[model samples]
Target chain A: MAPPEKIELKKQAQQLIEQYDNFLFDCDGVIWLDEKLIPGVLETIEHLESQGKRFAFVTNNSSKSRDTYIEKFHRLGFKGIGKHLIYPTCYAAASYLKEHLKVPAGAKVWVLGDHGIETELKELGYIPVGGSDPRLDDEFHPQHDLLKVDPDVRAVVVGSTKAFNYMRIATTLQYLLHENKSLPFIGTNIDRSYPGPEGLILPAGGSVVNYMSYTSNRDFIDVGKPSKRLLETILEQRDFDKSKTLMIGDTMYTDIKFGNDGQLGGESGGSLLVLSGGTKLKDLHHLIENPASLQDGPSLIPLKYIESFGHIIHLLSN
Target chain B: MAPPEKIELKKQAQQLIEQYDNFLFDCDGVIWLDEKLIPGVLETIEHLESQGKRFAFVTNNSSKSRDTYIEKFHRLGFKGIGKHLIYPTCYAAASYLKEHLKVPAGAKVWVLGDHGIETELKELGYIPVGGSDPRLDDEFHPQHDLLKVDPDVRAVVVGSTKAFNYMRIATTLQYLLHENKSLPFIGTNIDRSYPGPEGLILPAGGSVVNYMSYTSNRDFIDVGKPSKRLLETILEQRDFDKSKTLMIGDTMYTDIKFGNDGQLGGESGGSLLVLSGGTKLKDLHHLIENPASLQDGPSLIPLKYIESFGHIIHLLSN
Candidate 1:
């Protein structure tokens, strides 16, 4: 396969803007790092909006609900970005239980994440338990009541949580192993880490998800980026033309593989790589050099590369 | 291979005792469960001692140092069980640093476990850091001082810890990923879960070690059971003849494999599977029926099956 084309020239940026009518973005690295928005990202989004292009913010972060995300977007100067324009893994997990797994409404769902998953499960008419409960903060005890499997829990959803303690983990394992491991285990993502505030590389939701998966000795349904089911759900829900949409992300395996494997962007190809997040140019080059290192090696290679998504506006203006 | 021979008769039990002069016992499930001693186990050990047989306790639990283990042994009414006879993985990790890796004395070792690992590392003349630190108990903060990797830390040791939280995980990750993942990563064991008090299956050290390994995308050196290096270390240190040794445990993958792969008991074979702790007759039957289920299929199967290690005493007396 050919190397990803560099999008540094003004005409290249223009062509990119004209080629795709819809964009699916990975939140952490593509749009912003933590609470700080990347420079010129707003301007680029404004440029796309001025041109009538549509987009939605897709994040692997499951700690915050859509309502909290709207507040963050609004605080970051994104105008009129409503809940519909956001897609966090917490919502994906809840919807997966409801839509894909056909779990009945009002069924209890076990959670090992933060408040976002609890709020989203509740919004979907499911009672969330074992998440953000004050009792989980207690020290580890073998006789803890929460360690017993609650027969009412219809499914298990695990995602990112800062409150990752032995109490929470031991309790969650009971459900995963309950009924001969029949529970539907949903994992938010497979990302190892994310670029955090102050250039710190922080543990991401995938680490927590993988931790549970490893401990339980069971495979989990990944509902985050690169999961074709998640992509098809988003595309169908938004009514976006797959041939005209593009995936923009900072990571290769999750973002680029999502676009490439989904067969996005018709003849032009779909995925665009950016260096503003966890991935740098050197990392891309190394992947290109060692495609066989990954299982689906060639699929993770993006079609085009840029300094950052925000750099699109800089290229256009210059 | 044929299914393991059942040792339920008096003659078979006496013949087994005469066959092996040395025994390696797994602490959990085989001898005791938590603080309670399994009935008849003490009498069985006394019988072995009266016959001039040698034995050692090899536990995957890395949360307690050998000194602490000696105290536990005394508390449980066992006489003369000293530090040299107990081989916990915390000591294995510290000794591996000092002997195998040849990490110099006075070097700092990063720890992601409990006071046991710290105590063991300190005993080996290595300064232990990032373990049982009060600051690690603090809530998640990106700017936490411990997040910064200490340059002097030579290796990272990860084991089981009930106080597992984001702070310890994040800080350990920096060391694991430091210098382009150059640091040696040592994992205490690979036991997924252990039988705890109240018949609860608690998450073991392997889960924590695997979590870090998955998050860092790096392989760690196993310092616990089934690691040939650890088996060799015990045999060489104790001067036990492998041909006359038997490994008794409830777990198949760790304890049984340790004996079988090490070629214990020579032609008579090694590894005595007990049904008292974790594995049941059904689990052993399932494994026997489907040997292809494991990577090293037949090696995981034990040479003999018993109701419990303590049952041998009952059979001999009857």
Candidate 2:
């Protein structure tokens, strides 16, 4: 566990390009912050594309469907990014129901998120309920119809939503606690906060998921980043060798640990930290200083550090 | 060490009354379930009053102020229930700011709960903000003025609220994360759920507090039951001898642990669990069978068990 090597030299950037045949990118801080794209990120990705490096976009934000993300990517100047290349947690949750939990396509999936989850579930042939419902926007009442658990709901998916309220939480609790806590509880992510549009740190999807988990007094199946199942799915779907793949993102706990613990780069280590997003150089230094203070100490430590993934293009131009 | 003694016989009821000079009761389940009074509870309290026993009502609920509780008590058949004799967590939170944290009078306190916390803080010479404000009811927007923290607010108090929404949560998060999280963060209680009307269980104050804690990634000062500070304050305020007091509650984690950990009833052990609210007979059996399963296992186990606090009057009359 040496300190992460800073990718400042052009030689280092070239080595990074040659080190991996595939890349996994985290949205939000990594690719774009809100609606604004980071400088040179598009060029770096285009360079990778020109170099025949395979990649897919992975985001823990379950509020946007893959189709919505496609629009965002295209709007941000990303070209030829197909729906299959985007892996939002909304899609992961829906796919988890179908592939892992064996939930039938037509079964009802209770949602405590936004329209993204509802859209994904609908696209996957499952009926979505309790999400973005106008009724849940009403003030909480003891006898609200939604408070009663629908016997048809096969599982519960909790993610991020701007419409978080007591009605939704209380109703979701019924499903989570229904049948002696029998239903599968799926959480989209575990991110505490994210960089917001106004230079403000806003509560992220994990906070919402954790709130429900706390209220229900039960553990949830996290389908977001750092989850091995998600990593495995992405790797298998893209047909990329784990040893030759790299995870490039701004956050350490999710993206870095995801790459490191998944053995993404094999012995060379697969995770790279970028300062362009939520994490800064000081944050990396702090983690290196107090690695033992966190729960997953070593696994959270990234293999390398750089100013930003976009900095790679700047370095190559020099 | 052993199974809780069941207070069933008339002799047992009489002995219980003789054993304690003061009784601390948990209100939600022990006295009444919502607005409806638990059967025989008033008679039992009257019997204790006739025998010159003193008592105080303690509840984890922070939604209603002490004055509101007075109306509820009078609406039921209870007589002479004074405001000073109530120890709701709202009052505890306000008092903690004043006494423990040494926050100055007239200092602004940020609130993320209902009117109870605001009323209590205002009564204690503090200006309360952010709670029950109509603007917080608006849909969340990144550029909202409330997203900016007020430098004047000295602390943050979070508790239960049926009005919980993203606007309130997002606004409060600014205060909690303000000034490098330097402000004192006070949480009213830690009860996961309470028995609600219509035989339903509802999320409680702890869920809200925990949501903020998780979102902010900071711990809060819990001013509610099972906290030793709350017990000490009650004992000192009421001038009740620890050895002669009994804690009757519907919850094992909060009320029972409050009495047991505070060493109420001296070596005899102070807690008496009532199977009339949330905990059932089966729950107690499970706890007794597996003491090591919970975090605070031994302290949560009650010294005695009863059908209901009101059942004492029925037993004595027999």
Candidate 3:
């Protein structure tokens, strides 16, 4: 297969700012990294705001609440983004459960994530269980056979967590495998590895869910980026023209694939790849040399490529 | 495919005691059920002994050590059997590690079963860890991520245990997935369910091992019936004419299959199915009706079918 042809938005340079009305931005590597603002991110968002463009921040981290994320945004000098515009994967999971699964309102959702997800489940009118509850476990002396099992648990939701243990997994298995096989087994994302401090990589949600899924031979529903379920969740709240709306991110597999996969719903998708966060030109060159090796990116290349979000300024009419 | 045809020894009315010098017996259903001796079992064994036939008990239950099994034998009126004639799956697992995996004699085995297996590991000069060390765990306060991992641990052995919990599994995954992928992961048996009191079924060794095997995506070397590895372990210490040895048991899937699988090394294998302990002739008729449905059984049928072990006495010569 021929390598995807990428159109440099700066080279074409004609009404580039006029193409998209609603903009979806990936948070990590694009807007900021390690609690620091990346160069040109603030000015680009300010430009989008002046053009009356609709934008939202999308992230797969389910550790914190949307309010916390927005607070981080302000703390890191990002202006014009609000809590409503911040779409954390926890919210996506909550929305996906409510809108798609339509689980009974008062039913309990057994969670295996941080407080962020627990808060979402509660705000969304579901009883949440098994997250950071000191009463739920003992230090290396868990009596798993004495677990408090509730047959009314409607779903098992998992994400990144430090408190993951056998009691929770055994309880989830009891709920999913023995008690009720139809209960939704879900996770925020399927990322196997995530960045930790000092170049150390920590295991993410996928590692936690692997044993659960492997035991039952059941696949979990991932509601994070590249799944398009998150996009569906965002679109469910408001209207957007998929043909004109743009998804901009630093990653290829998730962010760009999210844009490309967004097109699969019978519309064209706009994607902008930024080098400041994830992909290098050489990575794209490798993809171009062996397009078939692309694990997650869509068939089409990003419509624009730049060194950072700051470079989008050069493509504008300002 | 044609269904296997059985040749009842009574049809020939010949001296059955003249056929084999070594006899291997599956204990659970063959000699006894629970603590009660099965009818005719005593007489059949007495007849075998009078004829100078050497017999041994083979069982998949790893919850008890060989000495414990022998104590049960003597306590239940089997006076001829000794500790050397008892081959428990726990012992087989120990032998497999030493003979097959060739794990260093001084290395730790890291068991996930009961003290019975722990005893066997120690007796064989390998250190055992993580079975029921109360100091290694606190009641409901398991810190799985903080587990103290030993670098010198050579193998992880799992068997049926009521104490199977998350800390052991987490530690095992840490060793198998992160520490060393080449480490041999072995289990004692493949029995998913075992008989319990008042006809209640119990989750057995296979259930505990399933999660470990599933997490590793690696098949465990099972040292129990139907696996043929246990038989190899028993043969490691003693030599027998495979063509002249007979395996007698209640279940067709494990015992008959064990006998049949034993012949895979290019020798004649003998098997006897007893109705007093397990599957009736009607079940065999059902299998014959749908021959393709036989799951773990081999292509060969039992050499004879009897109502109980006592029936074997009638075939013996004066």
Candidate 4:
């Protein structure tokens, strides 16, 4: 189709702002990176709050806990966002194991991840074990003898970790593969890489998952974004009306295509793409030229396009 | 599309033996795994030797050097095999940097592998730097700081490492991404996992290479088997008429598909799939039902079914 009409996008944003009561916004690239906020972000949030629009910061980065996000948001001048802010870590891990294996309450989980994954598994009534305490000076200490097969351990839930050891990972894979218990493997997300202060860092969680799957000779279930489970959880929590709800983000691979197919629940859906981060304008052109690249999911059609959140807010007001 | 008759394979092998005096055999599920030889292996070799056949063992496993393979083969009662046996580690490092980046001789290479890689890089005039010396009890010390970009460094060659550290890997990736003059990232092989005495172990070279690609936002050129360059090198060394030669192996993915038309430089090809190793008899039946899975590859046909080397020898002799 023709390039999305800007005028129509502005009109739709205006209508959505007037109608929707709650808005879920993605962090990382959407609002701020590290300590710096994206330009015009503060004003847009203030404007939305003035019009009584509720917003929650949702992120797929499981390295940090929700408390960490709250602290970071406040430090970056985003105040009033609470600890209940949505993150896919816990939900992803829970749904992942639950779907593939019979992980009942109190099932033992060997977790190699941060607080988000640890807390989520614990809350789900699963006995969480393993993983390193980041506070330790010798972070490389073998936290768990992953090679030693544990009959009680029902699953291995991998999230983000700074202390990724190849030997430990290999050992864990050995148990996961050879053990007759049929222990399932769960990956929080499959985002091959993540944006880091030093450009892009190896997202260890995905690598661990990749290693496990490759070694075990089986594929694990990814419960994070782009997989429909996280979105479904959000929709369930919000009781979102499918016909009217809109999913807004910058990446076509995750946000737009994910929202298009009612993966976020509900029968009808829409998406907004901002040319801000991750998937670039050139990528969009490439995708358009080769539609087959997107056969796994829906072709992206942004309901709105804006250079910054200020433009979105300005259009909403007008 | 009927399965190629056993008579056809015998005719093809006979032609190859007659035409080309030199033959190259791949080990690990090809000739033998641990101690036992593959079915029909000894008799086939005896028949070829009787016909004055010459062959060398070629393996992608760089964990053990040529001497190790020679020793292992000698123990397995394979007489007269020598050190000319080729492995991919050295060649992979040599050709990858030379062809892709034109890396000059004596440039420092951050080697994340064994002696095979180090020896090969040294041969190519690359000063193997980085990675820890296990004999010295050095705990994964990197040769250079990742934060300070080194312009003179040639490339990062990932091979198998006994001491695989995440921090070192992350740091190496950081240098490759931010510094190092956009050097070529090379992987010796892409076998995700390998069977070890303890069970399946993580193929660290493949893992590190994949992780670097993800973290550095770059794709690596793989040098081992199933890759076009390795296949071409093997074909060149053999000097066999491709139309007449038959590629036989138990693994359908790498061995059989390597000889298929879709593979790089795989113009003239024939393949025989055995039911002994990677691909099972059941899996072949499954693929036969789903023809789409076999597209862009050779026609996979069942060969003379045998359980052991003795059975294969008995059948072939008869």
* List of chain A TM-scores, every candidate: 0.99, 0.99, 0.85, 0.82
lDDT of 2 by residue, A1-318 (tens): 777898999999999999999999998888888999989899999999999999999999999999999999999999899999999999999999999999998999999998999999999899999998899988888898989889999999999998888888889999998999999999999998898889888989999999899888899999999899999999899898999999988888999989998999989998998887887787787888998889898888888888778999999999
Docking class of 3: incorrect
| lDDT for each residue of candidate 3 in B123-216, tens digit (9 for 90 to 100) | 8899987776774444322243335567788888888776554455555555565453677888887655444333323345666676566555
Name the top DockQ candidate. Answer: 1
Q: State the displacement of the C-alpha of residue B172, model 4, in Å, after optimal TM-score superposition.
A: 5.5
Candidate 3 local lDDT, A81-145, one digit each (tens): 66788898888888778988999778888887788988888888999877767654553222333
TM-score: which is higher, 3 or 4?
Answer: 4
What 10-residue stretch in candidate 1 chain B is worst by lDDT?
B291-300
Q: Write the per-residue lDDT of candidate 2 for residues B1-318, one digit (tens) a residue.
A: 877899999999999999999999999989999888999999999999999999999999999999999999999989899999999999999999999999999899999999999999999999999999999988888999999999999999999998888889889999998988999999999988888888888888899999999989899999999999999999999999999999999999999999999999999988999999998998899888898999788999999999899999999988
Task: Name the candidate, 2 or 3, with the larger lDDT value.
Answer: 2
Report how far off residue A81 is in candidate 2 (Å): 0.4
Q: Write model 4 residue lDDT over A195-300, tens digit each, in one string.
A: 4453444444566566556545577767765667666666666666555555666666656666665533233335666665555667666776776765653347
Fraction of native Cα-Cα interface contacts (under 8 Å, chains A and B) also present in model 2: 0.76
Compared with the true structure, what per-residue lDDT tens digits does model 1 show for residues A184-252? 999999988888887788888899999898888899999998899989888988999999999999989
RMSD (Å) per prediction: 1.2, 1.1, 8.0, 5.8
lDDT of each: 0.93, 0.93, 0.69, 0.60
Show the lowest summed lDDT stretch of 10 residues, model 4 chain A: A135-144
What is the clash tally of candidate 3?
12
Q: Rank the candidates by TM-score, best first.
A: 2, 1, 4, 3
